[model samples]
Target: MDRVLLSIGHGYSARALARLLKPQGWRIIGTTRSAEKAGTLAAEGVEPLIWPGTEIGPALAQATHLLTSVSPDPEGDPVLRQAGTAIAAAAPRLSWAGYLSTTGVYGDHRGGWVDETTPLTPSTERGRRRVAAEEAWAAVPGLPLHVFRLAGIYGPGRSAFDRLRAGTARRIVKEGQVFSRIHVEDIAQVLAAAMARPDPGGVYNLADDDPAPPQDVIACAAELLGVPVPPEIPFETAELSPMAASFYSESKRVRNDRIKEALGVRLLYPDYRAGLAAILAAERAG
Candidate 1:
């Protein structure tokens, strides 16, 4: 059987997964919201369709696997709301399916550890919507769904390096404010492993072993670049947008035991230090 993947809301994380799958002879149909992005996707060998304006049924019929990276809004999940019926009709033929969710669902842990079994008690409105979307996905009968709740996502182009270079980096120190994160490469690997070993309804938390304060990561990146570290600013005094402030409202360390034990997955960057170094190295090597 041909290996075809229908990736809805194909964004950063989905692109990483595509890098792995495309090299392994998989055909990917990704959805974007713009014509320019569709052209870019096509350049990367992805078949892109403008979503919300396009019929997803034909793509669903072609897919042996499915993944949705779309976040929910005030209403609900876009994929479920728009193409829920097509997905259900195509469910039985799908070999595997996955959902990209945020660790924010287990909100306000006060820097405590949370596992897969942690009860969903989101603090933010965005987190609450994810909980709703997860429930909605679960309601779809016969869908081979696996939910991966990701932590603060950082990578080559989207890390502290960008902020430091842009002169907008700040070491915002909030006491006991620690966050778990995963390298984009590690996330891609874990997703690949899950597809290889499909276990429907499996929930995994994807994060690095290190759960350090935001200041520490900024310091590490600055040191790596041989530049002066950004000045530390207390969270209370930091002038932040509401969106940025919302991120500081929760603190937690997410456990990645299930991915290791169940899928035999090994992370490339187990800590922020290692992940930062790798990103910096990739830039220099390029």
Candidate 2:
């Protein structure tokens, strides 16, 4: 293993992975569409390439592992649209390739449990686009593809605590509305495990053991912070952004057995309670 990871759309989850891998001798090279983010990655010891603008010749040639976390728009996957030829050229040398997808692909499971084998019946256009993107990567000849359907991602700087502190926390009660989530650290572990045990053409669901109600998570965060949980508003009455409202339309508890059984991953924060507590502790330490 050369220990070189080329991360496409190096954002939150990818950054966490970089932090874990760096201390263990992995060289992280990543792409960002913005100049500011490129500078940020450079400061973190990642060799940042400006995608859609910069040529991916050197990084693609050198990367032993590849991870793409970019979401597809209506047009299609920006990465494949931008660098298909270059990626194809580097395919034979790449050891493992991962596409970060969403669990929303199993749309509105009515709070029922869903696994990797569940047929994708996405209700949102976003989920439909993701399904399209997954197929796009799979069709790329000889690319060692692994699709990870990630549940809601919450972490250090992006948790319910931030919302609570900023006075944006709301308890929107929708009966039977439950969501599965994974900590960014857990996501990093899953990706690392997959890299260690490469399974070409594999798909895994990334989620914590607990599938819980949305309002309960907010209440838990408030409790941890010793703040009053905001007044609960019925889902129909609560004013929400279209994006936020879209989330309420689906309900599913995603199973993560494959990641544990295949990749040997034990989640560091197995539930929102543990995840939120760790985030608060980290903030206090700093």
Model 2, total clashes? 0
Cα lDDT tens digits for candidate 1, 219-261: 9999999999988999999989999999999999999999999
lDDT of 1 at 2: 90
Clashes of each: 0, 0
Error of 1 at 251 (Å): 0.8
Model 1 spans > 4 angstroms off: none
What is the model-wide C-alpha lDDT for candidate 1?
Answer: 0.94
RMSD of 2: 0.9
Which segments of model 2 are wrong by more than 4 Å? none
TM-score, model 1 to reference: 0.98
The sequence of per-residue lDDT tens digits that candidate 2 reaches over residues 1-286 is 5689999999999999999999999999999989999999999999899887888878988999999999999999988998898899899999999999999888989999999999999999999999999999999999999999999999998989989999998999998999999999999999999988999999999999999998999999999999998999999999899999999999999999999999989899999999999999988899
Per-model TM-score, in order, reads 0.98, 0.98
